[model samples]
Target: MFRPLVAAAAVAASFVVPPAAAAPTPATPDQSASAQQVRSAVTELAEGLSLEEKVGQLFVTYLHGQAADEVHPGNQRDFGVGTPAEVIAKYRPGGVVYFNNPSYDNIDTPQQIARLSNGLQRASRVPLAVATDQETGLVTRIGAPATQFPGNMALGAGRSTRDAERAAAITASELRAMGINQNFAPDADVNSNPANPVIGVRSYSSDPALAAEFTAAQVRGYQQRWLSRDSVSATAKHFPGHGDTDEDSHTTLPVVDRTVEQWRAVDAPPFEAAIRAGIDSVMTAHIRLPRIDPSGEPATLSKPAIDLLRNDLGYDGVVITDSLAMAGVRKMHPDAEIPVLALKAGVDQLLMPVDLGLAIDSVVAAVRSGELTEKRIDQSVLRVLRMKFLRGTLGHPLVDESRVDASVGAPQNLAAAQAITDRTITVVRNESLPLKTTLKTTSALVTGWGETTTRTLAGLLGGTALPTGGTPTEAQIAEAVRAAASADLVVVLTNALSKQPTQQALLTRLLAVGKPVVAVAVQNPYDVAHTAAPNWLATYSYGAGSMAALAKVITGELKPSGRLPVAVPGPTPYPIGHGVTW
Candidate 1:
């Protein structure tokens, strides 16, 4: 499934210069000092911690109100709880995972987000390494005229390594301004199928070499922490390779049939590249790779898989598991057993452990019973401490409360989102006029399929909602068919923020209409690629910025300059990697 960006050598990518970020008033640890002073702060913080506290530093937690007394957000009540400080202080959580939702969402402009994040940092006992899954070109938390960026396969399309590198650097810079330090991105999963239910647009390519190169460049660009170099760290994900599976791991456990030898040569390349380039973290996917461990459990709970990451790939960084509650491991593996297996399997820290007290009890019990060794626990703790040590978060003094407003989304952050959106718009199939100069008729049908894509396209494209039942029912399809027969064009949208199943249905409906349908895959090229209609433009992500880019590309405001990152197999019954330029 991995496809290499085979373009001739040339630097390629887009840049969005943003307003200078105001430095957070040097409150607690005085970040405005020389390297020596910062190092001194780090050292002072590091020297006093016991091994238990040190090991505790590696764990990352959600800012949700897991506790009973936590104050709930008035809007989006169930989304999460606690401010950044509460999460850090209560659990002594090493870091915080920034998840998007109706509450505390990342959909805000980057400037707003940057200031919000600054407030979060000030609340932290230590400078918690802020994290999010902002893989450019697909699955971004940011949006807007600053929005559009191509996914990995699009970068692979131009065979341009420089494009991948620049996008990575840009993504890092934007996030840094907003105060996010970790990006669990540039999915190294080598997507072999255009129909791969989950990993398609997110993966770099099915070609291991290409995945490796793209991932390497992306990490370097995202990691330049000092000066102009973006200080944000990169976390290459789903370590033992998840792209080959056709099944969706979010709902079901997707198993890969490849043998260890096969994976070593194919699936392991990008991780190898990431490690070589000095990445900070490696997040595991909820995938089952049997050959690696031979144990019945998925790769996440398998010792061989985690050990291979260390001994085989030589990754000395922290190894974190995907959400514990995700279906892949939750239903099959009882909650009590998950943490133990992960720890024994060599996973350093558990993420979103819903049953925290139980998890801690289980691990502690394992140690008391000699089921798990103290030495192993110490090693894991050491890894956690080392990482925080590197981040300069170990022993910084308390952050001030006065500067809380300084951190919301930052301008540079929003600019980066807009820049990527502008560059990642790939015009896959353009028939009549490459870029339609005029709408001809404003009465187009707008169907919102994915979450992020809908809001963006509706506002930018100026299309009438596909009536009340836009869910694409049988009646809706019939109506759409009749409308397409008479209307100027039919415009369908899938979330440019995250790809989902609804996008699949939307494409099927448009294809059934059998009319001149211009589809925008706000998610990934894979969203629209699976159904090869006459006109398909893939934005690779659904950010307001990216959606704006899509509208621009459709109307010739921004040229359709990007290429597909991964191959969108034509009609599939044919083969993967199928693409014919218009």
Candidate 2:
């Protein structure tokens, strides 16, 4: 699909500025001194560790509170009480990833999760790098008062670097407060393909430059370390690029066939800028790039791709692989062989290997048999230790378990999220806002996918609610149109009209009515391209904060200031940056 862009990308690459000449960050005096000291500490720690400890430092395994009723393989260890201590004693992994399963309500509160992290630290000789995928919006692992900020697309729509920084800073504060030291976020992918199932709202924008700016802001924000707390390492993930592919890597390996120049034009800038901004980690993607590496290896186990990150981008920080459990990589190799392949490919840490004990043994065997040298293992171990020292995990590794309740979702954090949401509700089309003045009444009909969401929007507008299930039947659309006939105005809420045929039908039905119809996109902004509604709004999120912010925008309490982060596909009346003000 992207093959034709090679020539244009080649021309663009010549004009793109090298990262060496990029704008320098305004680092404080204390930060500069601490940076050198942290590096020295990491080197010293690596030299003192034994061979067994060095082997352990290369693996970052997972520990989820498995559901009591659910039965699965490797369920022997519950990760409760004595079991985790024994596992850690034998395997001695470098880090542990926390996962919240939807099927089970395990570690439901912040305090419980914090206590779990503290227990894992106690069982390890070196401090564990506790991590989570707290990307906000649908991907946020931790729930509740922990401000569910709008996703990356909303931040791109707002187009405020400061807002991007604020969102990351607040997220980092909460994670560190709960004893989690790493955040796998601020996705750098340039979402060029609208059909991308996995990287849709996760990416900041389709424009490489815009994504680069926000990615850099997020990296700076996450590494800032407020309130004198330990910093949470910010990761710029799915390296090289995951945006051009339509396939999701979770179920199958997506192939991106763009030339190296195409990648540099659309994907490399963000990673280069992130490296310059001092990103603490880079995560490899599972997708295969045929043009970049002819051997047909996924980026996780390809030395050329990893070398591009190390040499071309000049990123010296820790390089971590995306979870090995994903079918993209799992289908390619056995559990025991994955750790060795990742290390030989220049990855510093192996994340969520299928079998932790088997992975450790494979790396140990590789070193002894000359397949992998002991010195090569030491290099990666040094980088992992440096990350822990830089994040303060080695020094002040423990959190005050009592403070977890007060600090996890502080009221101020929610306020910041709301403020960002308020600034990011994009008005793509409008006949003038505060529909009360245009229609001469507050009475309106609000219909959407869920009853709760429809009711929330209706209540905010002081109107009646009509729930239109995602796939609305003809009878349901008829009922909604009848309801719209009596109202002063009609507002239809949609997530993605391209994906939802019923929602598109409902929009067409509402527009058939003589009354003015306004369409509000709660999730994907692409719906606006399908409707000719006089008023259109895009929030890029269905999160609570974004919904409340949308309500304020509809009632004229807050102005819609956000621009479109990406092109609204199909036939849109507006350009990429189009938005209404006042």
Candidate 3:
């Protein structure tokens, strides 16, 4: 159903590394980069690339599922998109865009990603860009037992740029070790609007200056980690002002009505700072900005935004397009016409077009027919080659065992997650009504919460999926309510509402339930005011630490001391930064 489009957008896009020929590494090599020799080996593998293959390096197609997931019958894998092996042997896209679905074979370990990078390159016999949304906190793609740090908003509020820089460095180190060469992170889109559909916690801050500072620090942090080889390149994304738009681009084109003065002041600084900081890649957003291009082609197909990057900002790196299949482009042109238009509009590479081969052919045919210049194609290939060279994946596949494995998400990683959980597990307010010491209720009402799910290994916690402010549908809530009615203390594990309708409605509904409602806020401090559920606990970011912190509070491992650091508006039902202690 339409849920697929919404579900896909539900994947919160998010972020990070170090050093030199003398070599650079992070404090911990939880995920270590490949050695220079391996990088050299990969570079050597690039020596025999053909003309078509060289051209193929300019497009990054989004395959259907994960690398480990086997492609099934009836699922088309054309357009430079498919399993890592098939996509390599066939479409040979220059870069690959990952959709975080391990069930389809894509996974949560650096080793798994490294194996995918190796397998894909081995089949294609050419180096490629391995990228994903690895931003920690809210928009993280890689999760589970791994260290999922606080989101940009939290980092924006943390121990200064130095702390953020270290976080970014750690992130890049993790990605590089996993064979992920490029990170589509450091969301420069400032969280200027609270109701903005997509880029909320994903943005570094509501303030432009802070967002710019954190974005730059994070990118620089990741860049500092992997010198040149076995490093990860940073991509600052959603050019212009995707942060303030209320429309969700995945399903609809959200237009930013800000005047030129508004944009020049509010939306332009973060990106300007990122470019100035020497970010390697800049991605176009799908938002329609009439102030810039009134023709309604969206930034991805408009020359103005791309020109801003080149002529105005003096950015000479690659210009990456957001996925072309988004309704943003479909609203203006034929699906096949997306890649062609983007090329003509000054974009370097078409990202994740619906049909890989068709998209490639469209670009190729445009070049051959002189509609798109061959020189343009070469320029993009050169950029792709440069990145491949930098990462040392150019020569051949290097599947080093030490650089990967499930242990990447083992103990410490989960412990880090738990630590973050404790720090962010804020108690906005406490009535001293429900005591944390004693088992207050006979039947505990546990609701499904968190960015993903709340499934415990032991199955001891039987909670209904209370997908608050996140992605729970009506059907999901109906089930949650039924489960809550049978419990004594209802724990509503609610996700933050960043413009997801169904989830928000479910949370609003959960408040009236006649039980001791413990609302678990996952993403933001704002959710405290959004929920009417009297008793609430905030796990600022959901990860191992958050989960552990919540468990500790429930089991008296630690007492609730965190109060709401931010204020909430009244008449909003649930007041801002609101929290309750047992």
Candidate 3 lDDT over 174-285, as tens digits, reads 6766777788888889766667768766876666777788888877876653234435778888887698787799999888877767877887888888766667678899
As a TM-score, model 2 comes out at: 0.89
TM-score of every candidate relative to the true structure: 0.75, 0.89, 0.76
Query: Which stretches in model 3 have alpha-carbon errors above 4 Å?
Result: 1-51, 64-86, 102-105, 108-111, 157-163, 225-230, 395-397, 410-412, 433-491, 496-518, 531-537, 551-582
Between which residue pairs do clashes occur in model 2? none
TM-score of 1: 0.75
Q: CA lDDT of 27 in candidate 2? A: 20
lDDT of 2 at 551: 78
lDDT of 1 by residue, 1-582 (tens): 101101100101111112331211111233333423433433445455544444445566555422222354621232233444444544555566765675444335555455556555555444566678888555766654232466676566546677677777766655665666777887889887555777877887777887899888887777643223235667888878888887887798888878879988888999988887767678887887776656767777888788789888767677888878778877567888898888888888677666554666677777778888877776666555444443333332123324323332346645654655566666666674343546655555666565445545655767655532224466655665666666556777654312444445656666676666777765555554455666767665555666777777666666766665565543433223444333
Tell me the number of clashing residue pairs for each predicted model.
Answer: 69, 0, 48
Better of 1 and 2 by lDDT: 2
What is the model-wide C-alpha lDDT for candidate 2? Answer: 0.78
- Give the total clashing residue pairs for model 2: 0
Cα lDDT, all candidates: 0.61, 0.78, 0.63
Model 3 / residue 67 / CA error / Å: 5.8
Model 2 per-residue lDDT at 556:
81
